[model samples]
Target: MPFKKLHTNILERLERKDITTPTPFQSRSIPVIKSGANVFCAAPKDSGKTTTLILTTLHKLKCEAVGNAPRAVVLVENKEKALELYQAFLTYTKYNSLRVYVGYEELHIDIQKSEIFEGVDILISTPKTMNKLFLLNGVSTSQLKIFSIDDAGFLIQKSDSSAIISITQSIQKCQYVLYSEELHPKLKRFESYFMEHSKIIQI
Candidate 1:
C-alpha cells in the first residue's frame, strides 16, 4: 500500500518477496519517473535504485503495452551486472508476461550474430556488446522507451560510452534514467546531453 499507484500486478510480485514499503529513493524517484520524465537519481549503494528502475520501467511499458521489439535498454558496466539486473526485472515482470534478455560478451562470436536478442521487453547488456549487436544488425532501438544507465559513473568512464551514444541516437521516443552512487563532472556532462528537463533526485 505504501508504494501507491504502482500496478496491482507489480505489487503482487513484490508481495511475494514481502516488500511492502518503498525505499526512500524509490519513494522520491518513482513519482518523477511515473510522470514520464527523464530522471537523474543520486543514491547510495543498496538503496533500492535498481528495484525502483525495474518496477517503474515495467509500469511505464505496461501503460502502453509492447510488441516483440525491445522497449527498455539498460546499460551496465559488465555482464555480471547485466545478469543481476535481468533477474531483478524477472521479479517485477513475473506476472506481466514480458520477455527479458541479457547479452553475453563471450557469445559475441557464435551467437551474437543472431541469437543475442530474439525477443525482449527489457534488454540488459554491456555497452560494447550492444554496440557489436548493432554493428552486426542483431538488434535495433527503433522502438525503445526507456534508456537506463545504472552505475553511470563507471560506465561513462569507459570508451564504450561511444556505443551508448550511438544506441541512444537511434531511439525515437525514450525516457533516459541515469542512476549513480556518486556523480562526477564527466558523468554530469553525460546527464546534460542525455536528459532534457529531467528531475534530479538525491537520497
Candidate 2:
C-alpha cells in the first residue's frame, strides 16, 4: 500500500518494469523510509532492499532533477557496487530529468569533481572516495536530501566506518538510510553521531 503513496513518476516506472508487488521487506520498510527519518534497514539479499532505496530516493526528490549538488548520495562498498547501483538507478531515471553520477577511486578525483560540477542529482560512490570529495570540496552537500548506503555490512571495517563518520560531519541535515543483511554493532554506533532519532527496520 505504501507504493500507492509514492510519486507518480516512480509508480509509472515500476509499472513499466513489471514490478507490481513489494517484497515483504519493502512492504514494511517503504512507508517508514517515506517518513523521512534516518533508518537502518536490515534484510537479507534479494529482499528488495536496493529497490526500496531507489524508489524512496526518487520519491523524496519528487522524481525530478533540481539544482546542482546531489540531492541523493548512495555509498557503496567498492567500485563494482557503486557502478552496479548506478546502473540500477538508471532504469528508474531513464525517463526522468534526474542525473545520476558514479565515482570510484579508479576514476580520477579531478574528473569526478568537474563532471559533478556540471550538475548531479543522485551520486553513487565509495565511502573513501566520498570522504575525499568532501575534503577537496569536490561535491557540495548543501542541497543533499537523502544519503543511503547499499550493502552497508562493509562498514564494519574501521576505515570504511571512519570514512562514513567523516563524511557525515560535513553534512548538516538529511535523511540517512543504511541497507545491510544484518545490523552489526558498529553500524549501531552511528546513532550517537548523525543518525539522531533514527528508526530501524529489520526483516
Candidate 3:
C-alpha cells in the first residue's frame, strides 16, 4: 500500500534532505503505522529502520502539537547508540520546531530530576537511565503517543527486561515500534507482550 499522506510540514522536512522515497521497510510499514498499530520490523543492519522510526515520529509530531513535555520516548541500548539516534532525529526534523532530548547514564547530572522533560518532545536514551528518570518523576508516559525500542534485541539480550517492562507497562496504551537486526531468544520470550497484532517486516 502507498504510504498514507504525511503532514505537509513532515513532507517538507523529508524533502529538504532529498528523502523522497520510502525504503522497503517504510513502504510496507507506513500504512500500518498511520493506523496507529504496533510494528515490529526485523531487518538486517542498515535497512533504514532508524530513518523509518524518525520519519514516522516526525510525522506524528507534525500532525499534532506536543504537550508541555515530550510525548514520545525511544529506548536505546547505550550512550553511543543514543547519540547516533539523537543525531539522526535532529537531521530529519531540523526544519520543524520540535524539542528533542537525549538521556544516558553518564549524563544523569545534566538531567534535572524535576524538569528533565520540560519542553522536550522526544527522548532518546538507555532503558536503565530512562527507567530511573521515570521513577524519579523526571518524565511521564501519560501523554505519550509513541514508544519505540531501537535495537530491541540488544536491549533484551543485555538483560534489561526489567526496565523495558517498566517502560512498556507505563505506556501500555501507546503505539509501539520495535526494530532489531535479529530477534534474540530473550526478545522472543516477550513476544506476547510486544507482538500482539504487530506487523513484522523482514528485510
Candidate of highest lDDT: 2
Backbone N/Cα/C clashes per model: 0, 0, 0
Name the TM-score of candidate 3: 0.89
Q: In what order do the candidates fall by TM-score, top score first?
A: 2, 1, 3
- For every model shown, what is its TM-score relative to the native structure? 0.90, 0.99, 0.89
Clashing pairs in 1: none
lDDT of 1 by residue, 1-203 (tens): 33768877777788899988888888888888888898889999999988888888888777334676778888888888888888877767666677787886865444754553456777788888888777767777777878888888776555866777776666677899989997656666765456777778898
Identify the superior model by TM-score, candidate 1 or candidate 3. Answer: 1
- Candidate 1: misplaced stretches above 4 Å? 63-65
Question: Which residue window of length 10 is worst by lDDT in model 2?
Answer: 1-10
Q: Per-residue CA lDDT of candidate 3, range 30-135, in tens? A: 7777678887778887778888788788777774446766778898989999999999888866666787888788885335454554667888889888888778
lDDT score of residue 96 within candidate 1: 68
Better of 2 and 3 by lDDT: 2
Predicted structure 3: lDDT: 0.76
The residue-by-residue lDDT of candidate 2 on 1-203, one tens digit each, is 87899999999999999989899999999999999989999999999999999999999999888999899999999999998898999999999999999999999999999999999999999999999999999999999999999999999999999999999988998999999999999999999988899999999
